[model samples]
Target: MNRLNEQFEKYLLDNLPKSKSFHPHFEKALQQMLVAGGKRFRPLLVLSVTDALQPLLLRNALPVAYAIELLHTYSLIHDDLPVFDNADLRRGMPTLHKTYDEVTAILVGDALNTHAFFLLADAPLPADTKVEIVKELAREGGIEGMIIGQAIDCWFEKKKLALDELKFLHIHKTAKLIAASLKIGAIICNEKEIAKKLYDFGIDLGLLFQIQDDLIDALQDDTKAGKTTSNDENKNSFVNLLGIDGAMKSADELVEKLETGLEAFDTKLKNNLKKILNNYLYRHKNL
Candidate 1:
């Protein structure tokens, strides 16, 4: 692992929401999902861009990376609610609702979601830069993006969406946030030209990620996945839509596109992306 990657785990651990309250377990519940380990994929995309483009700003970028992580964790918490996937496990641990109560889980997700913006607002970057970062995160992770996608997914369950529509659903729900992470890092580094380019690539990368996840869900058990598996039977997932063989073909085409896309960046960004993506690029095949 990259040393920065190692350091980020510690940084995230040290910076979780902390407080004293009359409500006993709320504090613990707030910190539960954050502490429960999952792949720190989104934040690392932000950090990698900043690290490659502007090492001097790497330390300053921690807040940016952390803000993305907080938003992502909050989404996971709410996503695992009884209304959504309702899975008992997440990141290999019992979900927040199961560990505590549904109300606690809901409130904790709310807290994390709100705190993400607060981090951006409180970051030490210039006013304009902070505004851009906040706007990008909001546009990608809010109603225009993740929320609408989730709404579509839940609303359209058991109803088959066309291939393009499924792509739209996952792109907004998953890809846009991933795209925002890369673009936000570029924004922080003041690399405006490449920011859009990275974001475009991130969209495809995130779609590939979702497909790979669907494949994992179809092929792996809960014990292997550390979360619920075979649960997308009614959901409009790629595995359910395209079947395993067709999904694998889609993943293959995406991997090729992403490889070509990675090569287009300057050496620093390309190599950085390659390093992060190597372990994950063809991961579905193994499954």
Candidate 2:
């Protein structure tokens, strides 16, 4: 991993003060989920943008960055639950529901979801800034974003969809949060125009990302995936709509678009972010 990646990983694992001592159950689940290793890409994005804007971000960025992680982890927990994707494993370990129980998993996810905003609310940033971040997170992670996307995905199972429809579903379901992550981080830095650009970048980047994920799911072994593979067999995907060759072609085109989009930004920041994206693409067969 590169220096920025390593630092971001370390930041993700860094400890924080426990909020009082009233709730052990929720805290345990949150801590355990937080410790489980993953890319920590979203938080890295937030932190990196903050770094670009300011020399030091650990104090103001940590809580909000952590809020993003908690929300993400909560999404995974629910996504892995029996009712949704019925996934048993995540990040190469038993999912929250599988590790604990269905009810515990549900509560854990809920706790993370609610607590994420609480963290945001408690962030040391200015009140207006915190409000913007909170609103952005809620909008992206809530009904207008992931939830709706998930609904469309579930609704479209075993159903064929037009390319535009599929794109819309992916945009809402996955891309929005990514876009929001970039935008919110920029907002934290009080860079509105940059935030907007980051959000737009996120949209295209997210499309590329979800397409890669679909591709990986199509090709990878279940054990390697740590979750279901070919499970979206019934859902709309680039690999499902376009064949493997076509999917790869589309993904390459999207990557090109994403790169082109970054041309307007600071060369160094764009390069570093692209490096991270490249690492992801190279590590997975789908991209």
Give me the candidate number with maximum lDDT. 1
Candidate models: Cα lDDT each: 0.92, 0.80
Assess every candidate by TM-score.
0.98, 0.91
Instruction: Name the best candidate (by TM-score).
Output: 1
Q: What is the C-alpha RMSD of each candidate to the true structure, in Å?
A: 0.8, 2.4
Q: Assess candidate 1 and give its TM-score to the true structure.
A: 0.98
Instruction: Evaluate residue 135 in candidate 2 and report its C-alpha lDDT on the 0 to 100 scale.
Output: 90
lDDT tens digits, residue span 1-287, model 2? 76666665566677532445576565566566677777777877787777677636545887788789889888988888888888867887788777778887898788788988988998889999999999999999999999999999988888999999999999998999988887887898898988988999899888888888888888887787766677777778889999888888887787778778878888765765676677664443533
- Runs of candidate 1 with Cα error greater than 4 angstroms are none
* Residue pairs of candidate 2 with colliding backbone atoms: none
